[model samples]
Structures are given as C-alpha cells and as structure tokens.
Target: MEPEWIQAMQEELQQFKLNNVWELVKRPDPRKHNIIGTKWIYCNKQDEHGQVVRNKARLVAQGYTQVERIDFDETFAPVARIEAIRILPDIMHSVCMCARFQAAPKESHHLVVKRILRYLAYTPTLGLWYPKGSEFDLVGFSNANYAGDKVDRKSRSGTCHFLGRSLVCWSSKKQNCVSLSTAESE
Candidate 1:
C-alpha cells in the first residue's frame, strides 16, 4: 500500500491534470527563458485536540525565482474577506497567496501561517451558521483604508453583506485609483 503522503500527493497531481491546470511543453532554453521550479509541500491536518485528521500535499510554484515581466504578468487576484467574527477559508487563501508573492517569505510568513494553522486547530468545527426562518433583512457594511498599501500608495476597501445575521458575500480589494484624501478614499 502506498504511504498516505504519497497517496495525497498523487491525488493532488491527478486533480491538477484532470482539471487541465497546466500543459506540458518542451523545456525552454535556459539562456532565453527562466523556468520556475516546483516544490511539493507536505502537511498533516490536525483536529482541535491536535490529532492528525488527514494527510495533505500541495504542489506549489517557486514564485521567488520568477521575474515580474519575463515569467509572469499580473499578481492581482480577486480575494474575499468576510468579517463575521469567524475565520473563513477565503482569509486563509488570501494569506497563502500573499506569502507566495513575497520575495522572501522567511520567518514572518512562516509565523503567520503557523498562527493561522493553530487557530484552525483550536476551532476545527466552527463554521457559518444560518438559522432557518430567521430575519430576512439584508445589511451591508463597507470601509476603506486610505493609502493602506505603503508600497503602491493605494487605498484598500472591503465590504460585507449579511442576510439576517449570516454573512452572504464579502470582498476586500485595493482601489484602482489613488485617493487624494481620506474622504475620497472612504
């Protein structure tokens, strides 16, 4: 029987191939083009009491070696952030993406990831709860941070919609235009 980690890796690769995640092409000349390396990350999912619940493996592109224009174009991806006093999967995805983009995600990124993992372990069964026959009122909340991103000097805005105390939709994104004032950003 195959080891659990190996089986998990095989499953991940199989899904990628089935989904047409990438195509196989002749290796580009080393002199002209830079071919990014790939790595397999193995992790064990743990429950609230620290018991191993599942074995997981992920194949990730080595983004550090990638050049901005030559290897990839844009880094912006739509991410959703919901503020319902609970941690959701979208926040984890966002954090992972952010760590991937960092040129050197050394200690700080590792610490952040570990913190998130610990939080997940502490709340394994937590999830959004929407009671039936609850109030049907739709409420929306939005806020913007002026020049939140120091590197780009762009404002960031986030909005969340609630349907009777249950979060339905949410989005957090950097503003397209630079805001001149806090009022404009808001």
Candidate 2:
C-alpha cells in the first residue's frame, strides 16, 4: 500500500481499537458461500459547538449488495423520543434527589463509538453547522391518516417540530387501535 494509504489504514485501525466496535473473527475458509465486503469511509469530526476539529475514518459494510434473509435478518431499530431526551437531565436530577447520588452507568459508550466510526466511515464529508444570521422561531406540524396500517387497520400519525427553520424533532407512530372516528382519537 502507498504510504498515505497505510497511514490512513493505521489511523482507522487505531480508532477501531479505541472504540472496541467489533472483533475480526477468522475461521477456516469455505468453498463458496457469501461474504460481505467493506470499504473505508472518512469524515470531518466537529465539536459540540459545531466546529470541525478533526477527521474521522471508519470501515463500513456494503449492506446494499447483501441479500435479505441471508447475510442479515432485520434492519429495524426503535428510536428514542426527543422530548424524553430533553427531560433526561431533569429526570436524572429527580432520581438523584430521591436517593444517594451515584455516578452514571457506562455501557453504551463503546457501542456509541462503534456507531460513530461507522457513521464517519460512511459520511466523511457530512457535518453539522449552526450558521450565522439565522432566524429564531419554533414551529411544528403533525398529520395522520386513518386505515393506513395493514396489520390492524390503525392510523399512522407523524409530527415534525422545528426550531428556527431547523429540523429538531419528528416522530411517526401507529395508533393503539383502529379509530372509528378522527374526533375519538383526540
């Protein structure tokens, strides 16, 4: 490999080691099954203030070429609510006040590192920035359609809340049960 390429690979490996993302397990070679291929991805790392301070590298699997029910099973993942996240600090404080204070548990940090690595690898140029001269206003919109659920004939409601023209929160959820009328839903 070229010197520059070697350097980049080393950096990526180092980051992987730090993250404890995954271990490369090796076994006896098979005749001809299926193996997913991966590629290097790079991106710029920004600080909490939305300023680029470093470059990140990652190794990402080419999931698109993978066949369903073969290489992977499910790609579904549940998302946390933004409102819940915004209340986390207060919840933590309440919990602390209720009992003797203790340090927060740390388990998902490594997984988060792994996720960051994958994200950086896949979107090397992607970044977030708070531009100057931006308006300050809070706006939101929600919509729902009945009989959209194929399983139980339930409606699906979607809401998106924005802050100063920036998308900050959104959600989509199926109703608990089929609503006979829209007014009954409210």
Candidate maximizing TM-score: 1
Query: Each candidate's root-mean-square deviation in Å?
Result: 22.2, 21.7
Error of 2 at 3 (Å): 28
Tens digit per residue, CA lDDT, model 2, 6-120: 6656777776677675688885356575666788776566689999665555567776454443223333333211122122222223323333323554455445445545645
Worst 10-residue lDDT window, candidate 1 = 78-87
Clashes per candidate, residues 3 or more apart or on different chains = 0, 2
lDDT of 2 at 128: 54
Clashing residue pairs in candidate 1 (N, C-alpha, C atoms within 3 angstroms): none
Which pairs, if any, clash in model 2? Answer: 42-124, 43-124
C-alpha lDDT score of every prediction, in listed order: 0.68, 0.58
Query: Per-residue alpha-carbon lDDT of model 1 for 51-80, expressed as tens digits?
Result: 998888877778655434322343433211
As a TM-score, model 1 comes out at: 0.35
Compute each candidate's TM-score over C-alphas.
Answer: 0.35, 0.29
Candidate 2, TM-score vs. the true structure?
Answer: 0.29
